[model samples]
Target: MSTSPTDSVLEGVLADLAAEGDLLETLVADLPEAGWRTPTPAAGWDVATQIAHLAWTDEAAVAAATDKTTWDALVTELIGTGEQGVDLAALAGGAVAPVDLLSRWRTARTDLAAALRAHPPGAKLSWFGPPMSATSMATARFMETWAHGLDVHAALGVEPEPTDRIRHVAHLGVRTRDFAFAVHGLDRPTEEFRVSLTAPSGDLWAWGPEDAAQTVTGAAYDFCLLVTQRIHRLDTSLVATGRDATTWLGIAQCFAGPPGEGRERR
Candidate 1:
C-alpha cells in the first residue's frame, strides 16, 4: 500500500525527532562525569539538568498519550500555565549518576516514540497549550530537543552541525507566530506575515502569501536559534519588513510559556 500524505508527514517528523535526539546523545554520551555538572546558558540548569529535563518531558509526553491520570497530575504539578515557571526541580527524575541519567533519557525517548506511534489517528493529544495531533506533538518534541540540545552544546564548547531537520524547528517557529504574540500580550498580526528562511540545503522554505507586505527573511538555522532563544535577535542576520514583523523578530519563541528576556545582546 502506498503511504498516505498524512502518514508520510508523521513518519518524517518522527524520524527527524529521533535523529535530533541521537545527535544530542552523540555529543554528550561519552562526556566525563564532571562535564555533566557544567553550567549552560539557561540560568541554574547544568548539562545534566538540561538532558534530564528533555527526558522528563519525553516521559510526560508518553503519559499524556497513555495515562490520563498521570498526565493530568503532571500538568498540574510540573507543567505550569503562564505567569509561573516550570518546576524543573520537580521533574529531575532523581538520577544522580551520569550513566543513570543518560540511561533514563534513552528509555524515556524510546517510550515516547512508541507512544506517539500508537496514538489514535486523527485524535489530538492534550498539552499545556492547545491539543496537538500526533504529528504536531512529534514536531513539538523535536523542537524542544533541538533547543535544549543547544544548551548542552554551548556548555560543552561544541558548535552544532545544523541540518535540514531544523526545518521542523523553523516550521514550528512560523506556526507559533500568533502564539508568540499572544503570550506577550500583544495583538497578533491580522494578516499572515511572509516568512522566507534559507534552509541548510540552500532551499528556500517559505510560508504565507508571496507578496505579503509584512515579511521575515533569514537563514533557517538563525531563525530557529532566534525563536528558541538560543541566540539573541540582535545577533542574527534576520530582516523584518513591517511593524508587526519587526516586533516578532524581537519576541519570537517556539516553545511554550511566557516570553523570556532572551539572551544578552551581542
Candidate 2:
C-alpha cells in the first residue's frame, strides 16, 4: 500500500516533535528539585510549570485525536475557565514530584505521537480553536515544545543548540499572519506578505509571492522566538517591509488563545 503525501508529511512532523520533546527532557532530566522550582521568564511559571504545561497539552492533544467525548469535556473544562485562573491543569500537574512529572510528560508525549500517527488521514480533530489535521496538530505540538523549552533553558541559564527543527515553528508563524491581526481585533491584511527566513542550516525557507508588496525577512530562529512570544519584537533581527507587516511582527502569535503578554526586551 502506497502512503499518501499527508502520511509522509505527518511522519516528518512527528519525528521533529519527538526530537524537540527529547531536547526538553535532556534539559530537565538531571535538575534538582530546586532547579525545577526556579522561575522562568513566563512571570509566575516555574520550570516545572513549563514542563507540566507541555505534558498537559500533549495529553489533551491525544484526547482530541482519540476521544471526541473526552475532548469536548476538556474544552468545557479548560477553554473558558479563566474564571478558575490560568491553566488549572498546568498548576495541578506542576504540583507533583519532579520525577513523577517528568514521567508523566514522557508518557503523555509518547501517547500523543502514537495517537497522531494513528489518526485518520484527511480528518480534522477538534481543538480549543479551529480543528486541525493530525500533521498540523503535531506541528503545533513541536512549536509549543520548542517555546517552553526556551523557558526551561533560560531558567537553567543554558543556551539551547539551535537546529533546523525551528522551521516548523517558522512555518506556523508565517501561516498565522492573519490570526495575529484578527486576535488583536485589527483588520486582516488584504494582501499576502512574502516571508523569507534563513534557517539554522543557512538555507532559505520562504513563503508567499516573490513579488508581494509586503515582506518579512529574518533569521528563522529569531522569527520563531518572536512568534512564540519567547522574545520581544525589539530584541529580534526580523525586518518587515510594509506597514501592516511591521505591525504584524509586534502582534504575531502562532499559538491559539487570547494574546499573550510577551517577553521583555533583553
Best candidate, lDDT-wise?
2
Candidate closest to the true structure, highest TM-score: 2
TM-score to true structure, per model: 0.95, 0.97
Please give, for residues 141-192, the per-residue lDDT of candidate 1 as tens digits.
9999999999999999998888999999998999999999999999888987
**Which sections of candidate 1 miss by over 4 Å?**
79-85
- Candidate 2 structure quality by residue, lDDT tens digits, 1-266: 99889999999999999988988899899999999999998877899999999998998899999988987887777646752434677778898999999999999999999999999899998887799999999999999999999999999999998999999999999889888899999999999889999999999999999999999998899999999999889899999999999999999999998898898889
The local lDDT score (0 to 100) that residue 145 gets in candidate 2 is 96
Q: Clashing residue pairs, candidate 2? A: none
Scored by lDDT, model 1 comes in at: 0.88
For each candidate in turn, give its C-alpha RMSD to the true structure in angstroms: 1.9, 1.2
